[model samples]
Each structure stands twice: as C-alpha cells, then as structure tokens.
Target: MRYNYPHANLEFAVEALNISDESTLSSEDFATMMPRIQSLALRTKQWVTVIGGSRQVIQQLVNAGVSRSRIRWVAGRDADQREWATEQALLAGTSSVVLSFLDALSSPRVAQRLKMASKVSQTHSFVFRSLPSQSPLH
Candidate 1:
C-alpha cells in the first residue's frame, strides 16, 4: 500500500514488495523500488539509515542519485543487533528515514517498539521483509 508521506506522523506505515523467494532479496526487486526511494531521499535531503543492507544495495542507491554521504549503510552482526540499531537510529533522530531488511519481525512488541520510536522521533521507518508466497499453490 502507498503511504502518504505528508501525513506519516504517528502512523505505523508499511510497504511490502513481493519477491520470488522468501529467503532472499534480489537486486531486481530493489531496482524496481529505487526510484521512489531515491526521490524521497533527494526531496527530503535528510540522512537515511539502511539496516542489514548489502554493499551492492548501498551502491545502487548512490547510483540512483542519492548522495553517498547522506546514506548510512549498517551491517548488524545479528538480527537482534539489527533491530536494536534500527531503534537507536530512529530514537536518536539522526536519520529522517530508516530502512530495515529482515526475514520477519521477531515479535509484535518489536513492531510496537519501532512504531513508538518512530512516532516519538518523527522518523519514517520502512521495514522490508521476504515473506512466504501467499499463493495457495506455493
């Protein structure tokens, strides 16, 4: 679903991208979404933190027109660390947007914590997950 950025305050907005497999995120999947992401970064001119993203993915953002200096690519040692980093980034108010790549949210409390942190800091958070196919035949 599309989120209205202008009215994003205090809202737990989520946008999911469909992928061929639930275990991996392909370059093509991210490439397709680059334009929108790039536009948001450029328009806002704010720092963006990417948690658990690869070097290639970060390069793609730079190649897509986002300033390399404005992007912070974080590689957490583990899932828990990644979640912690995401929360800290939001709560610290150092980034205007935080993109997290995870297999799945560990728990509802995690989501609640993220939402509350985003709300308090007024930072936009986007969580990208590789969900199992919804098709019954899959």
Candidate 2:
C-alpha cells in the first residue's frame, strides 16, 4: 500500500510497489518515476527537489531522461527527515516539485505540515517510502 495526500493543481499518487532490495528502489522502479518528475520540471523549467537518492541514483535519473539541470539533489545526513527538507524547499521558493524518498506520510503532524507547506509554496511534494517487507509502520 502507498500513502497519499491531496494538493489542488498538483498531482500525488502512490501505488502498490515493490523493489527487489528492501533498502533501495530498483532501477526499474526508479525509472518508472522519472517521467512524472521530468514532466513537472519541464513545464515550469524550474528545479525539482530530489531528496535522499545517492549519486548513482541521481546519475541514473539523468541518464534515464530526467534533466540534469533541473535536478536539485538533497541527500544530506538529515534527508530522512522529510519535514526539514520540505521546509527548505518551500523557503527556496523556486522549485515546483519536491520528490522525497521518505515516509513523510507516516506521521500525522508531518503529513499535515507537508499539506500546508505545499499549498503555501504553490509546489508539490511527492514522498516515496520503500514498502516495508515485514511489519508496517502505521
């Protein structure tokens, strides 16, 4: 199962997804998400915040057709804390979408904050959580 949030004028989707590795998204899974990000970025010609992906993943996204110039990688030590990154993105005021490989919707407060932040910033937040193989978080 995938978590979802509502954002008028912005699209948010989550589907039953699985990756071969429990820790990272497979190439195919990652590939499946690029076009949507690319589409959003290309429309505004603004940066797209990509949170938590490593250098290899970022490079793969570039090679797979996501614009290199439009990508703003945010794989810092605190990247897992989606709220902070989303706050930073909102503060920047130049990005149209913030794609985070995190469980932003896992916490009620974070989810609510993200909703308000996206609305105020006029941007979209797409949080991606690796489907847990064992127990659920919520």
Candidate 3:
C-alpha cells in the first residue's frame, strides 16, 4: 500500500504485516513494521491516538509514516500533567496521542475531561489503556 500525504510532499509505501511475536522483535524490526501500519492509518484518514502505552511504540508509529500532525501521546499521570497533555492532544487535531498508564486517571472527573477532549478533536484518535508495566496503585 502506498499513501500520499493529504497535503504536502510526503508519501508512504507499505507492505508486510506480522501480528505475531511483536514483543520479541527488536527495535529495528519494529521500525520495518511501522510503514505498513501507517499505511493503514493513512488509508483511514482518521486521527490515531495511543493511550496508556510507551513512547517507543508511539515513535514507531511516527517512523511508519504516521505524521506528527496526526499523533498525540498521553498517559494518565497526575492532575497537572494529565490536563496539560489532554489540552495538547485536543489542540493537535490530526496527531496520534500515547496516553500511558491509564490507571493514573483514578478520578471520574479526569475521565470526563478525556471524554470531552475526544468529542472536540475532529480527527481520528486512539487510546492505549494499558502498557507493559503494572502499578500497585492501580
């Protein structure tokens, strides 16, 4: 699959997809997988938000052809960081966001805030509710 950027001198060519053994793969391998995934994202023309995940995963998506303008990385942290990240994510209408550690959002109020951000963003968004780490507080 090849995707031309919506507006700009950018394009992505993608092929091959392997859903198995993703964790075991090295960083280099992940880099190779990125383009394929990004092609799918481009085809959808929707904002992709990754919540509760790692910066590495988000970076991989960027490498795969996902535009920075269409990505946001958010992880439920404390009140201030969460609010700041949420605001930034919403402002970035077409960017993918990585919201890591969903458990950090222990308040209903925070959840409501996230819901509002989702509603206002006019692009495709994705949320990663979990990551490789586990917290006792959660």
Instruction: Please state every model's RMSD to the true fold in angstroms.
Output: 8.2, 9.0, 10.4
Which of the predicted structures, 1 or 3, would earn the higher TM-score when compared with the native? 1
Predicted candidate 2 versus true structure: per-residue lDDT over 20-132, tens digit per residue? 12433443465586776666656666787877655766676577566888789876565346557866785576886776666434455655666566655667656666323
Error of 3 at 97 (Å): 5.8
User: Can you write out model 3's per-residue Cα lDDT over 1-138, one digit (the tens) per residue?
Assistant: 443445431222111111122222333443464554475467655566654457777776776777766765556555456555654665565543223333244455655555555444433223323344434665
Worst 10 residues of 1 by lDDT: 15-24
Each model's lDDT comes to 0.69, 0.59, 0.47
- Sort by lDDT, top down from the best: 1, 2, 3
| Candidate 1 structure quality by residue, lDDT tens digits, 1-138 | 333456443323343222112423443456676777776667577798999877776888889888899999888887898889988998997776777776666777777787777766667666765323435772
- Decide which is better by TM-score, 2 or 3: 2
The regions of model 2 sitting more than 4 angstroms off are: 1-30, 79-82, 103-106, 130-138
* Per-structure clash totals for the candidates: 0, 0, 24
In model 2, what are the clashing residue pairs, if there are any?
none
Q: Which is the leading candidate under lDDT? A: 1
